[model samples]
Target: MSWKLQSVYMGMTDVATHNVLLLLKSVMRQCANIELNEGGNLLQHSLWVAYQAQAAGCESPLVVAALFHDIGHCLCAGDPELPDYYRDREHAALAATWLSRWFPASVCAPVAMHIDAKRYLATVDPAYRMQLGRGSKQSLENQGGLMTEHELSAFSSHRQHEQALLVRVFDDAPYVGECLPPYTRYERIVRSVMR
Candidate 1:
């Protein structure tokens, strides 16, 4: 899709917020290469994840997090430097950190832990470990398993674990229909959360 980000602040309350949106727009313009499955695009992938997060009963913060989880891909230029790709881990932490001012920790927590959660799952569940994609597996092998108690402790403390898992599940869920339909879903989720 043509990533023509209309340079409009619409309802943005402050300059900082407007700037962040501009940043997103700029990144979208540059990241035309990202493609989602079956004629889908990065925008669709983002919206779908947010849509499903709302449908799956995720709260507002989590829903928002789902929507912007991959925004960092545009800014950081494809997944921030991390130790593992074995589980398709990326720059979730960096994204989460940047989002902190705009969103609550409850929201950013899952976004931040998205990568570590994959690593945690890999270590705890062999079945899950087996299902990881090639990129994930390669990263896991290269990074080795979640081998420290501190890492395990950190993953455990994240209150967004369940929500993060929900986001993860939908992130890869089948996109069976037109992407336009999901936009409404995303809107509804965001509205519900904001309420």
Candidate 2:
């Protein structure tokens, strides 16, 4: 038998817990059909990012943000074939806005600026671009083809710049081809930070 969110919900009766459960289920369902070009689906990549965040000693909210940072992709059509401009900013923006319903700025802010962080790294650290896969490079173009010097300076001043950069750093790490810790493992972290 496989682990399931519904199975974990049987004994839970709190309204907030119920809501989170529903959200998790919806995310799982939505991500099931969306496949990434590199391999794996959105949910797996999400879990991996969260796992990396935790391992990197990121604060709880940042870890949660990592888990769902790309959730906007799941929330929308997420079609890679759409056009150059539709690559990821829309998804990042959507995720930040959607996550704001339950999470604080600590969470939403990072999700919102993660793309900018990527652009910052790619432009500021010349060798950084080499680490990205073909898919990420194409997506970066859709995200405005790297940041200008002024954009990087402005982005650095944003209150959550470091947090977003941390999220992006973990997100950019190579996937290890594993299932990741189960969602239930992070429920406490999620509930503790909910608004």
* Alpha-carbon runs more than 4 Å astray in model 2: 1-17, 78-84
For every candidate, C-alpha RMSD to the true structure in Å:
8.1, 7.1
Each model's backbone clash number = 7, 0
User: What's the lDDT for all of these models?
Assistant: 0.64, 0.84
What would the TM-scores of all predictions be? 0.68, 0.85
- The TM-score, computed over Cα atoms with residue i paired to residue i, of candidate 1 is 0.68
Clashing residue pairs for model 1: 85-136, 85-139, 86-136, 86-137, 86-139, 86-140, 87-136
lDDT by residue (tens digit), candidate 2, 100-154: 8788999999999999999999998879998888888988988887898799889
Model 1 residue runs over 4 Å out of place are 1-32, 36-41, 78-90, 141-144, 177-195
Clashing pairs in 2: none
Error of 1 at 37 (Å): 9.5
Residue range 42-81, candidate 1, lDDT tens digits: 6777777777776778768887888877665655655446
